[model samples]
Target: MKYNFDEINNRLGTYCTQWDYIEDRFGEKDLLPFSISDTDFKIPKPISKTIQKVSQSELYGYTRWNHEDFKGSIAQFYKRRHDCEMNLDWIVYSPSVMYSVSLLIRLLSKPKDKVVTLNPMYDSFFTVIQDNDRQLESHYLQAQNGTYEINFSLLEKQLKDATIFLLCSPHNPTGRIWTYEEMEKIISICKKYGVKIISDEIHMDIKLKENKHIPLLSFLDIYDELYTASSCSKTFNVPGLIGSYAILPNSQVKDEFLHMTRKVDFLNSPSIFGMYATMVGYTECDDYIDQMNDYIRKNMEYVQQFLFENLPDFHFSMPDGTYLGWIDARNVPFTSEQIQDAFVHVGKVAIMKGETYGKAGEKYLRLNCGCPKAKLEDGLQRMKKAMDWLYNNQKGGGPKE
Candidate 1:
């Protein structure tokens, strides 16, 4: 591979969120962190080169992102990569995907209107929904045989009065890429109930398998009120760039959205560097996507094998997508809080406590595998030590092989 996925680069003292800001999230410092979602790999050369070239010009200015160069990059990307027809006029820019989601929730529905989504979902969804004064109706995905499936029967009930349905494709936390049949079921129910659909496809480009993501926009023919919030940020590891876009192709919805961003918030212009970075990422960096998947897949395999051999009580499956490893420690003798204390204070390694996602996630733990294999090996060892400490101390010095 042209990129070095094995090099151990130090990120300390650089104000890096995963390494330097552990205290903010975990309330402790100096522990090995597998906490945040970003990766340790360097971004594709094309993106960095473009940013550097632009910086050399020494010109900074407010810029519009509604034009073809910005939106066209996104449209062309989806057309070439995902085989979806994206209209240039339907495209609108936002500083981030969640920003779009928060605005769409307001524009598409009213305060106190019910927003239905799968529980144990991405953590930010909880904050985004509740903070917006929207009532949340969780139609949780059922876990079975090392995978999760949406509970459609309960979903229909939840959507019956719901004004919006927020979806996470190639879902975060659990990492199950929605199949066509599953999506069809979701769409059919929403259609019957006249519910609007808003999908966050940020993880769509992080494909770890042969199945291509059927973009929510692809179902525009079946449901016109559909919208998708996505970015090349996750695919290219450029979330710090502060760029994302939304496909709001419904009647007057785009106009209302622009009013919110342009009129109310003065977010009419995007960061020039971030917009350029996104354009180059979609246009010139296709190869990096495949290489990244290959490296992440290997890291995931390493985590699986190491856990099976060393921490058998931790049940994990190779997620269909994303760099996150969701492990079920329900069978472990210790409670979630016990294991969390062990992971932080005892093992001195920070792994995300599953309960943060939702109550359904309480029995699980999420590990960020988007790092160099050497780093991943070290983090896994820390996890093992945490578990070993739990066993030795909690079980009165239980014997082991």
Candidate 2:
């Protein structure tokens, strides 16, 4: 079926965190926003149909997520897409991927134990670790030729006594998918240090061009203490449905994890909508995913071209995966604070600052190219307008602060 990715849907007044609630993050309103991770695209019809069907029934009730329809569908997806064999029993549902990570941080490590992950990671990784009283350790990734490489020497140092090696596959902010050999090296290091692996593969399905996402599960033979937290929400743009799962390999730990979900977290049952959404997403939405990715890659190319042609000071390289464009504006001759302020106050636009991810991201900004082409163009125009004004300011002949 042909998907209408060009169709623009008005998200204003929807109480969405990406559009309606930017005041809390950007400290302003009525701006064209590319801040939040979720996209503006509509959910796939198959998933939405099930959502509507459940809504019309007026029979919303506790739904079990351990059924074959849920786990079997997920297992089938991995086997079909990535050639990864997953045992249905290893799947355990959670409210969301980050929630699963939070639960696992507590499950695997004690308070103040170090958890090492890449620098400039998803902002929540910083919070989830600190919030759980786990010491957060940073290992900076080396970016070369528009792609990022993990610094194994420093990573191994940080992993010495670290309890958890929290990894972001098809990483956020910068969309480089780790290759199989790199994954093997990471697994080897973790094995040497006895660091429990918790990989967040939430963006696993957003493969751009020919890049393939190798699941952390692929390293099972090399390391058995691996736990991967992922969800169909990112793939199907249904994060609001609030459901995710963790692939736990160890039987004892998996049982304990399920027990915690049922007994302590009190998520004994999952959201009916979330359960159906996952099942349909994994089964019926493969074609939709392919088309959406094509649209996203086109948008990414457009962003790169726009920045090169119009905003020459800013640089963007087509990422290996994900719908976000990481714009490097280090040569723009302005601090991220100045640029961000100009974007909101002068240009009336909101894009996430690089610093929000980590200190290393201070000269960069993340743009969400996940919306319709028209919306993305408008956003880029607003951003360019802001940058133009900043450039003019240095000449002492533009809009003042």
In candidate 1 the C-alpha lDDT for residue 111 amounts to: 91
Q: What does each candidate score in C-alpha RMSD?
A: 2.4, 1.3
Give every collision pair in model 2. Answer: none
Kindly list the per-residue Cα lDDT of model 2 for residues 176-240, writing each as its tens digit: 88888889999999999899999999899888856799999987988898999999988888888
Q: How far does residue 117 in candidate 2 sit from its true spot (Å)? A: 0.4
For model 1, how does the per-residue alpha-carbon lDDT over 193-227 read when each residue is reduced to its tens digit? 99999999998877776666889988888988899
In candidate 1, stretches whose alpha carbon ends up further than 4 angstroms from where it belongs are 395-401
- Give the whole-model CA lDDT for all candidates, comma-separated: 0.88, 0.88
Question: TM-score for every candidate vs. truth?
Answer: 0.97, 0.97
Model 2: residue 215 alpha-carbon error in angstroms: 0.4
Cα-lDDT of candidate 1 = 0.88
